[model samples]
Target: MKPSLQLKLSQHLALTPQLQQSIRLLQLSTVELEHELERYLLDNPLLERAEDYALAANAPTTGDGEIAPRSDAPAEPSESASPDEESWLGEEAAYLRQPGSFDEDDDDYHDVQAASISLREHLLSQLGLMTLSGRDQVLVGCLIDALDDDGYLTQALDELAESMPAELDIAAEELQIALIHLQHLDPTGIGARGLQECLALQLQALAPDATRNLALEIVHKHLELLGNHDFQKLKRLTGCDDEALRAAHLLICSLNPRPGAQYSTADIRYIMPDVVVRKLRGQWTVNINSDAFPRLKINSLYAQILARQRGSGLAGQLQEARWLIRNVQQRFDTILRVAQAIVDRQRQFLDHGDVAMRPLVLREIAETLGLHESTISRVTTQKYMATPRGIFELKYFFGSHVSTEAGGACSATAIRALIKQLISAEEPTKPLSDSQISEVLGQQGIVVARRTIAKYREALNIPPVNLRKSI
Candidate 1:
C-alpha cells in the first residue's frame, strides 16, 4: 500500500540554541568560562568585555541580591571599620606618603621566574669540572643522557652499551666505570639502577659509623623488611637494639630516593573559587567571587549602529551576543543558588570541621533548588567553593552515606575524617589497623567496613598498618 500524508499533533522537548548555550556555560569551570568568553569576544564584534564599565564595580551579586565587594575597589574610611582594617589602612597610607613611593617610570615591572636546570644539564655541568679524558667524558655523557627524570638508570649498562654504535667501541665494563663516576656526582643517587641502589649510594655517602653500617646492611639486603615495617626481623637479622634501629630508620628516611626530582619542573595549576562562604551576623552566607565572574556587555558603538539600521547584517550577531550575555549571567546565578544551598546544608561542617559533615547527595540539593540532578552535577563538577576550612570542589561536599546505629546516616567523608583522626593519635609502636579503625567507627555509631576504611585510607594517601609501624 502507498503511504499517505497524515497530520499529527505531538509535543516533544527541543533544546533551542540559547538553552544549549546556557547548559554549556553552566557546566564550565571559572577558568574554562573565561577562555570561552574570550573566544566569543574574538568571533563576535558586538560582544566586548565591560571591564571599564562603571556598573562593573557593582555587578557581582550574592544569593541574597546584595552587591558583593570588588577585590580591586578602593576602601573608604568609615567609623564601622574594624581596628585591624583601620590599622592596615593607616599603614598603607603611610607607605604611600613615604618619599619615592611612586615610580611612574617603572612601567615594565614584571615577575621573572628563575630558570630551572634539568637533571641532564646539572650532570653535564659537574662533568665539565672533571679532568676525565675526552673518551671517558663522552661515555659518561651518554650514560647521563640515559638516566630518567627520577635520577635512576633504569636501562641496564649492557643494554645501553649494545644500543651504542659499534665503531665507538663502547663496552658494558666501560659503562660500569662511567656509572661509578656518574654516581659520585652531586646527587649521590643519580646513576642508581633501583631503589635499593639509590638508598645504598646515599647511605654510602654518609660518614662511616655503626649506625651508618647497619643502615647500609639493611639497605643492601633487608630493604624489603624495612619497607614492610618488620622491625623484629630486621633487628634479628642485623642484631641491633631499638635505639640503633631507630637511628638507622631515621637516617634512611632522611635520604632522597628521587634526587633528580628537585631539578624536574612541576606543573602547578591554580584554582579560582566560584563562590566564597562567610559567616555574617551569626549566619553563614554565600557570595560570588568577583574575580571569577565574567564581566561582559554589548559594544555600545555596534549596538547603536544595529539599532539605527533595520535588518542590518550584524542583527543576528547582536542577538547572539545578547543570548551569550544572558546565558552567562544565568550561569552565575544558578551557581550562586546551588552554592548557597550547599553552604546552608553543610553549615555544620563549617562550624565543626569534617567530623560534623552530614550525608549529602545531588538529589537533596537539586530538589532544594528545584533543579535536576544532572544540572546539579554539572554545576558541582569543576566548580569550587572557598570556605574557612579550605578551598574544595563543590562535589566534595556530596558523598555516599553509611548507616548509623541510631537509625541515621553519616557521610563517608565524615567517616574518613574519623578514621584519620584515630590513626593520627595511634601509638607509633602499634598503629591502628583497618579492622581496629572499623571497630572505632562502629563504637561511634557510624558503621564502616574494614575494606571501606582501607579505601579511604588509600584515598588519603595513608600507608597500611604494617607500613605505618615504627621501631
Candidate 2:
C-alpha cells in the first residue's frame, strides 16, 4: 500500500453544522419554528422582522404596474401566497402592529405570543405541591427524568430507583408513594409504567363510582384485550353481557388515550400556520408566509465584529458568516420545494376531504420532486398545513396504499377513513367485524383482505369485533 499523497477524491456524508441546522429547521413544526424564531430574536441581534421590509419592498412596486394583482391569484392570497411577495406588504404591516393577537383565541395574525408551559413545568409544579423529604424529592426528580415523552415512567421502578444511588435499598412502597404523587401532575399519568397504568391513574382521578370501578378493571385487566377487540373475554371476565360490556367500554372510552398529552405544546394555544391553503375559482392553491419565515441575515453586530478583525485574519469568523447565509438560503429552498410538492400531491385533499386523498408515499414524492427519501421525510416530519378541513401535519398526506378493482391504489389513510365511516354507520348491537368490513369494501369494488382491513382498523385506533360489540 502506497502511503503517499495520491489526491484521490472520495465522497462521504459529513454532518456540518450548517447542514445540521438546515435539517433541523426542515423538520420543525409550526409551533416549534416559532419557538426557535423567538430564541433567535433574543440571541441574534442582526435578524429582524419589521414593517420597513414590507414598506421597502412595496415602495418599488408602487412606481408602476410591476406588481399588479394576478388574474390567477386566489381570493384569499394573503392566506395562501408567500408573505414575501410585494402584494403582502399590507399584510406584513398588519402582522407587526398587534403581535399578541396571534393567540389561538384571537383572530388577528399580528401577535407573537410567549412560549406555553411545557411538560417539565407541569411536573415541577406538581413536585412543589407534594410534601416529601428532601431526599425523597431528589429520588422523585430522578424518576421524573426517567419519564418518557408520553409522560409515562418508561423505566422500571427498580431501574429508576437504582439511579437514586443515595436512596439505595429504596422500598417499593416509598417508590409507589412518589409514583402516586407524579400521577397527580397537571397532565395525568405522568409517571405510569404503561398505557394501562396511565389510563387507570387518569380514571382514578375522575369522580369515583361503580362505572369508574368498571373502567379501572377494564383498563388494568383487559386493556390489551380491549385493544384487540376481544369483547368475549371482556364479557367473560367482567361477568357482563355484550350490552353491559358496551356500557363498560364506554366508560373506558371516555378516558384520554394519551393521558400525558394535555401538557403537550400542541394544546398550548394555537400554532401560526407558516403556510395557508384555500379554494378560489374552483382551484386550490398553497401560500407560504415568507414573512412568517423571517428573512435570516447575518447579524450586523457580528458583521461589525468581523470587520473589526484588525488584521487578525480570522478565517473562522469569515467562514462562519458565509456558512450561516448559505444555510439560511438552503433552508428556504428546501422548505419551498417541499411546500410545493405537498400542495401538488395533496391538492385533492384540499379540494375534497380525507377520503379523496390518494395514496402518497414519501419515495414517490421524493422521486418526483428530485430528492432523497430521507430529505422528503425531513421536510414533512413535523411541519403542518392549514387547510379547509383544519390543520394537519405534512406527513398526514403520506400513507400506505390499498388497490381498487381498477388497480388504482387508495391511501391507507383513505382506507382508514372509509373503515371509520363503515363502523360509524354499523349496527351498535351487531357491530361490523373485520371480515364484514372487508366484504362491504369488496362490494364497493375496493380490493382488500380482511387482515388488511384489520391492519388499517388498528392503525385508525379502531377496536376489533368483540370490543366493538354492543347489545
Candidate that would win on TM-score: 1
Q: For candidate 2, lDDT tens digit of each residue in 112-205?
A: 5443776767677778878888867766776777776678777777665565556377766678777766776667666878778778888888
Model 2 is weakest, by summed lDDT over 10 consecutive residues, at 55-64
Alpha carbon RMSD to native, model 1: 5.9
RMSD of 2: 9.4
Flag regions of model 1 displaced more than 4 Å: 1-8, 53-115
What is the C-alpha local distance difference test score of candidate 1?
Answer: 0.82
Task: Judge candidate 2 against the unseen true structure and give its global Cα lDDT, from 0 to 1.
Answer: 0.66
Model 1 Cα shift for residue 238 (angstroms): 1.1
Candidate 1's error at 313, in angstroms?
A: 0.2
The local lDDT score (0 to 100) that residue 76 gets in candidate 1 is 41
Tens digits of lDDT, candidate 1, 1-471: 999999999999999999999999999988889889999999999888765433223355443222333455433434766664455344333323332221211222233344389889999999999999999999999999998889999998899999999999898999999999999998888899999999999998889999999999999999999999999998899899999999999999999999988888766565777776656445676766655766677777887787799779998888888788777778888988998999899989988999989999999998898999999999999998876567889999999999999999999888888888999999999899999999988888888889999999999999999999997
Off by over 4 Å in 2: 1-273, 290-292, 298-319
